[model samples]
Target: MAFEMFPTVNKCESIGREKHTVVADMDGTLLIGRSSFPYFALIAFEAGGVLRLFFYVLASPMAALLYYFISESAGIQVLIFAAMAGMKLSSIESVARAVLPKFYAGDLHPETWRVFSSCGRRCVLTANPRVMVEPFLKEFLGADMILGTEIGSYKGRATGLVCKDGVLVGKKKADALKKAFGEEPPEIGLGDRQTDAPFMALCKEGYIVAQNPEVKAVTSEKLPKPIIFHDGRLVQKPTPLMALLIILWIPIGFPLACLRIAAGSLLPMSMVYHAFWALGVRVKVKGTPPPPVRSNSSGVLFICSHRTLLDPIFLSTALRRPIPAVTYSVSRLSEIISPIKTVRLSRDRATDASMIKKLLQQGDLAICPEGTTCREPFLLRFSALFAELTDELVPVAMVNRMSMFHGTTARGWKGMDPFYFFMNPSPAYEVTFLNKLPKELTCGSGNRSSHDVANYIQRVIAATLSYECTSFTRKDKYRALAGNDGTVVEKKHAHLKANKLMGC
Candidate 1:
């Protein structure tokens, strides 16, 4: 049968399909993109690093030729080999669980999702390697089963070859469905291309998803579970062209990043702001900043919503003065390079409070009470310790934008964060200072509890930044992304002295 003969997915009834079982193709049917190259590039970059990504980009032309002229399975095999060849199986799984979901969530097809999500049981059939797509499909998309090409592995490492059955395309998809359901086929099947026709024909009803570039992606709020925490260095999807550009930029960007870091570290506090602008790091400060307090007067505490490790540095730049900031899990390199004094915080309440109070006595102090950086527009639970220390709290909302590389990572080295952050073509930071807490609202003068004061400041900062407040804390973030509680244990011979610090 001709592909055009099948009805469009939009024509199918989704309102009362909760009892039905639906089988769908992934690349174009469920996701907005038709080509699987970007996802493959992501895996290569995130799991195998820049070299692997370069290899994958180099192999793309061959994949494309095979895809268009030869066969879908042949093209995907090239991508699989280029991206996953010799990569650790564990590394691939880690990326699939922690990194891919955020990207996948951003590209959901609205029309296809309307039908697929409405069904009680959903299955995804794709030519992409199963190891790279299963976690996101099962966990975030509420998929009941995933029928896809399986990658061959040996001793916990990928062989970069498909399993015996090979890439699930054309007749293979129909056979898999038949094996999975026996004589009873799915109640509905949704597909995007002619190759998907074979499997769609096996369903009780089949609908084709027509190519529509104008269709908007389904919002993250519509997903079964929101992507709250994700890990990776890449800020955007790396298509073949983008990947090549990134590989090309690194030679230039690394030195530029080094210069940016050096200038920030060596230049005087007042001169650093101009130096940052000259080097392509933009700092935009808003709101009226209070004048620097005298050494005798207790320093005003700046409570910032954390976006990155550079929050305090940017805050100090905005104020044009070095403010001693208390930090948690900051790398030794970060501390050494920081222009302003960075005091490591001991999780012990009394000691940290005392240290912060001492710093306040010296001058202004900045602290991220969220205890960790959150990339999304959601504020983690504020640590209430800072609220109790003093009533002179100035809530600051921090925002950062990066195009190429994220300045943060949960599964990689922390020292490279500053370099990665600066590697972007024009990374930008906005620091908005909210009103200081009035004496009446403070724990020192008012009857408010420390928790109440913290919550109030959190709300103030969240409102200023247009972010949502979450009860999720630093531990919650690390547990989700890194499989740990965001805690670091100091070694006997470690450079830093803090016994236990929160991981970034």
Candidate 2:
């Protein structure tokens, strides 16, 4: 039986293959992150408003149950597509036209797009309905053929029915390719899911693209992603319930946070650390600190990576001592709620560098050179300002782990307090204090500029985590997210009235 032919992946040093039929999967294979349906659904929720947002997320599992008991995996996929019901084709298409380019710019599987572009007879074969995936493929990749579920619609909206053909999944997908091509199986196939194996057999060879090395290993060596870290945060499109929760909790969380900081003034630093545990923080530490320098250790500069506003608080708690922190771009009042001293950055680099030196000479100081919380895995280029201040640089790696409710954010209201972050059921933190960078990295005596020292220290941290070290600075990230080419400062022009125009 055809079921006997499972797909196998073969790894090659390069994807220089030419003139082969490229049949690719849409979700995990071609796109870097989540599948197309969920991503489209997110855009729907954003534009459709709050009630629709809740319905989008909750209705899926319920519909999946209804479909699964009646049919199978195919039914589950149809339910996922059904979430797009009640939208005019024109409306959805307009949203797709805007969001698709931004998504493509920000995320991609390393080799899939380029090879698919160059290959002959490019086809997108997926269980996601052809209508839903069509506009993007037709517009961007010049898709010659697309084989997917057929959606029956009434008036303008999706009918949530798998018209005559049903969901084209697994073996059925291979059958669809045969029926369309009317020849030998395609010359090459690309996919990420195990379900894609049968269709892959239609090709002379295949490449499996996914984050899980073991999954990729079953068919091929894990493919190298183009960017080590792409923008990782989901758009914070809160459903009505989440919005209500935030509104109700703000009244409560905002006040209690103030009291917590006030009480922190009197509490011993040890008491403060455990109190955070009461709010569900589990911290793990690695490496040794240079023998307990008294709370008054001089010229000890801590170079930390940034993830959340709560970073310095977590650090002081982990070290069991207060370390005043310096930052840039935080809201004006963020420091009022902090239990530790926060020196906001000044515009002049020379003056700021002088101020940092004075602070270090008095006691330990911590600074996040990235100047922003990176939701992605990779580290942003560290600022050389700290490297310019002094050479006693100790690199601190900070990661905030949260499954359902993230403690870290790059977007949220200005006044949201740290205690509100602790409201997450349990948030684990990992901290690594690597040995102070060697004298070569210090280079404070002017053998090298601060930029070189900053780059080396960032590499040490990136190496520890097997992360891709990039020179992409915070400004580069903001530009990519906003879809602005470098040098265009997107300030509001006086005539600007409608919000979020032209996707920039």
Candidate 3:
């Protein structure tokens, strides 16, 4: 029986026919939200590092032009495949096989897969190259037949050429269906895009699995609601504008940041609040109201969760006090321009400790023991030095969320990260201050090791953010990103990813 939204085709009378088949488009319909083809290159590039990915990413623009001016999306796909030419087919197959299990379990759409499995014969008619999806279609989907574009290969390597059949697109797709299932139309069909319309015309029962209800409203207004399915997944397709949008927010950032620093440093604390709020950075504070940062008191030490380079800046904005900060890697020049006093650590334990002790003696001081900017919720092991220095520990938990630009980074010139963060229309921060650690919790008479005090602070911050507590450290992340060995002679750079294309 056909899904009710679709008209029961005349072919229902022949339901028991040996080839009673249901066909679906691969990219958006049967598979997950995105097209299945281009990911083939990503799989291939796992063996080749950032350079290989960089080369493909560079060619994407020409591919985009071809999409608009010449053929449809098929042209862009061919360009992508062409770049993979000479790549070992085994490399492609290996990554696909390794990840297919997880992809099917996670990324594949749940609702559509059910409708797909309910059909008699599972045939995915797609413009994606057959070899790319064939392994999974056979191993995972139990596909009876695949109508897809074919790639030419020689001696276990891609040749970067589409076979003589050309891209399986538009009218070509409709003709291919007729060639296989005879001149008679299909009994059941499903598709997501207008490009899927040609073959849909041949279906006895056709359904549009639209992501946007408005699209279905305007296009299939007269069509019955149930047959016009909506699984509520965003359609993910390659777009030229993504790279452009990421960068448009960058140009004016530096100037605005200079103004932010100058204003925050010179103006009254209340005006400092207005200055950042004007730039659309809302700082939300919670928990009990603490005592004043500046007082007749001798000294105060602030221990905070490491989020971005601007953690202290955001903290400074929240507390209305520019506490001098001690850091491991930040340069002295960067600190000079900052609104707050910053102590750059020399990475020498004794020297750095002396500097921190002296700074604390002079006035209030702040430090992020995690030692690095971590974009993820999990944190690195906290340095125990902060715990050893002061019993008056002020645990500050801060997090920043941005839509247009991410402010945190592991590499590249992070000096501009705050500017990039402020570039967003509405950059936001959630800051929480736990009650100052009591004598027992703070490395006091119970004679707690600095390690114990550090772990306690880590737990408090992790619980506040609802982030997973992990033993992973900056060294682990550094090795992953830069292939850093124990010695820092010259860390080999990893393969450039799509996200890394825009500066960190």
Candidate 4:
């Protein structure tokens, strides 16, 4: 094939190419993966839920057969239909923006990136749907233009059909490039397959990306922008085998998850830790927990770095006692199932402060000031309210591991968070209690401002967990994932009372 004759991307000079424009193929050229199945599975699950994913998986064999025997476009069309047919366009876009980038960032080809990133203008040409690939390419990879197959949609729902130009393979890819660049061809073209050869032939220079399983992917740190927040249930990319395993496991896992949750909820606080272990949930506690306080004394405030909705429950498990936690936004179902007390924060500075102070006076309190769960090894900006509420602050670093499924989602129903988390086989939580803040360093002691104290505590927990701290807040997280500020609208009665208080 023509692609076999082209020089490998590794042979292309990647340095001193600021003035050059590079047109690259998406999957194997820019990213390490040669197949697009995992990504389609991701979109399938994220947009249409597990049933859609199962349907996609069932059709995978046909897609594979057609891919190898019939045509590449035929395989892709089958995937698009299985994954996206009848799904809302909005949901697909949200997944593209929030979920796909993290996975895509992880799969970046080091050699391809070296050449692609060196160019002044970058373009990506692929058979993947334009909506699916555009956001990640433009936002993360800084591509100047994207030329890809367009999905047919009616009334905001995908029809699972490609547009008239069809899947951008062979002559279609070359034709699209001609239409995009006019007489001025791109300086460099990178491709991984013979199908990509047509477009690669149009560029001034062409480099083939050969299949090499041993090549290491470009690390997340090397990306143009770090992915701080992402929302999806699947922890790892779902290849055909992985997808099959997941489908097979869900029936067994759900009941197991329900049993585990029941054990944690029904068992006594002291015994919950042992029950969790029996149920295949591992809770590892490190460092000394403060002794129980007297009834009359103000409670010790536990400042925790949030990992999931279960952070406080695990914190309570670590302490062998129930610690009432203040939450920014939690579903009613989550509150109902929670073993420890969960107090909702109103987001009002004075009201929340008073509520937390009252909780502290009642006994020990656990608060995650980051206000949201961050999946990465990073802490969001602390709220500072907890810092001002008490000097008896002990930073808690919380981390969780799930091999099969993530227990959290920004776009999905919040009630399912716990259930999804428990569904993971042998899920684990690590809770490390750091040294208590000295009285002199606290806002209550008049030695530091609220923000200063909060920042100090954030740093302390971050250092303990070996995580980087960022100024990204709950709003930032929601905006990236759900396209809104992470604020739950209050009930009518509560809204009226707040309005009356404000004289609105």
Ranked by lDDT, the better of candidates 2 and 3 is 2
Estimate the lDDT of model 2: 0.62
Using lDDT, rank the candidates from best to worst. 4, 1, 2, 3
lDDT of 2 by residue, 305-372 (tens): 87778788778878888889998766655676566888878968988988898888778888998776
Q: After superposition, how far is residue 291 of candidate 4 from its true place, in Å?
A: 0.8
Q: Which 10 consecutive residues of model 1 have the lowest summed lDDT?
A: 495-504
Total clashing pairs for each candidate? 0, 1, 4, 0
List TM-score per model, in order.
Answer: 0.94, 0.60, 0.58, 0.94
Report the C-alpha lDDT of model 4 over 1-504, residue by residue, as the tens digit.
477889999899978899999999999989999999999999998888888999999998999999999998999999999999999999999999878988898889999999999999999999999999998898778899999999999999999999999999888999999999999999999999889999999999999999899999998767775666788889999988999899999999999999998988889999999999988999999999899989989999998888889999999999999999989889999988899989999989999999998888899999888888888877777887777778889988888999998888888998998998999989999999888888889886776898788878877787788876666678878886764523212224323543343222
Name the weakest run of 10 consecutive residues (lDDT summed) in model 4: 485-494
TM-score of 2: 0.60
**C-alpha RMSD for every candidate:** 6.4, 10.3, 11.9, 6.7
* lDDT of every model, 2 decimals: 0.86, 0.62, 0.62, 0.88
**Segments of candidate 2 deviating more than 4 angstroms:** 1-17, 23-53, 65-121, 125-224, 230-268, 290-298, 375-377, 410-423, 437-441, 483-504
lDDT for each residue of candidate 1 in 226-332, tens digit (9 for 90 to 100): 67678899998887778899999999999999999999999999999999999999999999998999767888999998888988999999999888889888998
Strongest candidate by lDDT: 4
